[model samples]
Target: MKGTNYPNRWLIALAGIVMQICLGTVYGWSVFTKPLMAAHNWSNSEVTLTFTIAIGCLAISSAAGGYILDTKGARIVATIGGILFGLGTLITGYGDQIGSLTVIYIGYGLVCGLGLGFGYITPIATLVKWFPDKRGLITGLAVMGFGLGSLMLTMLSPGMIASMGTAMTFYIFGGIFLVAVTGAAQLMVEPPVDYVPAGWMSPIGKKSSDGMTLGQAVGSKYFYLLWTMLFLNITAGIALISQASPMAQELMPSTMSVGEKAMQAGVILGLFAIVNGLGRLLWASVSDKIGRRTVFIILFSTQAVAFYFLAGTKDMMMFTIICSYIYACYGGGFSTMPAYAADIFGTKYVGRIYGWMLTAWGAAGIMGPMLFSRIRQASGNYSEALIITAVGLAIALVLPLLAVPSKAKSKDAKVA
Candidate 1:
């Protein structure tokens, strides 16, 4: 490590945040849902499927992208992801102009989803290696942009749609995304071998030690527990997210015009997006002081209570408070999980390990939105779906209690 002149690590972190902010706009899918539905005469379930497919593809792509990132490097993968995402968005706009739902799905759901996966994993995996000394805080900071990306798009999308129309808006955003994401990705690179921050010592007195491989990690009970916990948390949180705008509007008095309702819902959605981003930074940093498992426990317990209140709330103010809390905990799970996996499986293979763990995200993306949409369509309200998510969260609370940390070894990991 001597004589090495490292690029400023903080700049790498900045680049990662910028890329994530672009990728994170997928969370703003709900903002486009009603418009798309009205434009295409698609049902809620049909429109929601675009988001589901994008996320499903994101999980699959990220799983594969992790290996490429670990072996080939972060810059290439992120750049490719950026290109794919921007291209996909452009394609979606073109598909809209032609009125083809299938084309839109391919553009947004499949193409953009793949891009999201590749772009998303690059930062977390790369930053984990660069900042082992501040694993929790750094990973949190890296992903905080992703959480906030939704807010940026949410605030901008409505006005943009009103002024330019959805397709043109998508076209413009696509160009911006292409420029922004790839530009930032150019700044990303892996640290040198055996890199360490100046003045910091590894508590173990080694540059690096043996860590669990992807196979070894998958063999452990810890992996399964973490995966299931993530699944449950995402399932509950995303159910609301997929429908947040319309659901908020549903609670409004009938006297309000459609535009007014959309504006109010946009405001609430914007607030949720803000807390979602902040929660990542707040909870992940807190996990450094407490423990990762303890942080997850807190997230689960508090979110469970919030969901219980959310199931029946009709008052807009009360509804906002409850959803914001749930959003925080939901975002916390994401930021905390990377650190948690690093602690259990070791940072060496966390890219692969955590990438695979995101399959839970794919599954939840499909399950949460589909289930929420179906229940709403059938029952004419979100109450039943909200209650179901509450119960799921309550059950998930037990998984963290069972998740005890274990040491990573060069040999195959045990079921502990």
Candidate 2:
């Protein structure tokens, strides 16, 4: 029998990227930190908490959203997520206008965050089924859009806030997200069951272990191992992101004006976002050839060295390069892990499986930034925190080494 021909998987991928770019707005939250602090007279940790809440919410909601994506469908979940995100943004603007931090937290952190989680999982879960032939490459591309989303924000936000103030910017962003994310979501369609690309065999055929349900995956050691590995990587990267602006300013000469410091920091943040997006594409694509385990091992090992260097470096060029590398590795973890989970657990229920796995992201999201900021606040410098981070990463290097798929039928069993 002839295989069923879908219109083009690339179209699905394109729509996924569009939705992700809007969802990626979460990564750009740092750009608002200083402005919000200045405008609202909030403390560093207080301002940072907004981003943390959003991330934590994103993780929690994604886990729930994944189950929905698996059972209900991607389009409805994505649409609702997009609407919540947009509404959240608009509400945050109102909160700012009212001088109410609580409202800001609800709008930007809780509501928008839930939107991010749902919007995030839909594409990744849907696209992997559509492109089993290029799991690593396609996932990389989708998340690469998410990484780049920050770049657009970094470039536009400075000017927007300067001209219209933070409140108006939030309102504008809310409108854009509502239209963009929801519209892109409308284009998403699940592939037919048992769909396979022409002339390419499903990786399931080349494996001894089949897909595991959410409960079965949770019951295994591999789930926690992978979860821990992702948590450590995300924590390290997110710590830097939570304070990328102030951290950069601290390293600059004292003679620089606050505006100058912010401008320079903005440049660094933009660079961080750019390399972050590209890294997802590069590292995940490489994983396809060299293997995900090797890529992760390389990421953990090298990033440990990078964090160590980042601790004591005062030279701007070296500092920026180190930050870029770390951000790239952080982005790589996001792009690679979905495919990694799919490979091990099987894609049959990846939406639900990977969504639960992202709870690590939620936990790390709260832990990473809060830990980094509180440490910096108390110690008056990020050096000690950076050093501590380096040690944590060095320890996590052993996880990927020990990570292996459970329930293999043979000792030599491997994922294709």
Error of 2 at 103 (Å): 0.8
Q: What's the TM-score of each model vs. the native? A: 0.96, 0.96
Candidate 2 residue-wise lDDT, 87-120, digit = tens: 9999999998998999999999999999999999
**What does candidate 1's lDDT look like per residue over 76-179, in tens digits?**
99999999999999999998899888998999999999999999999998898888778889988988899899998899888888788889989999999999
What are the clash counts of all predictions, listed in order?
0, 0
Stretches of candidate 2 exceeding 4 Å from the true structure? 1-3, 203-210, 406-416
- lDDT, candidate 1, equals 0.87
lDDT of 2: 0.87
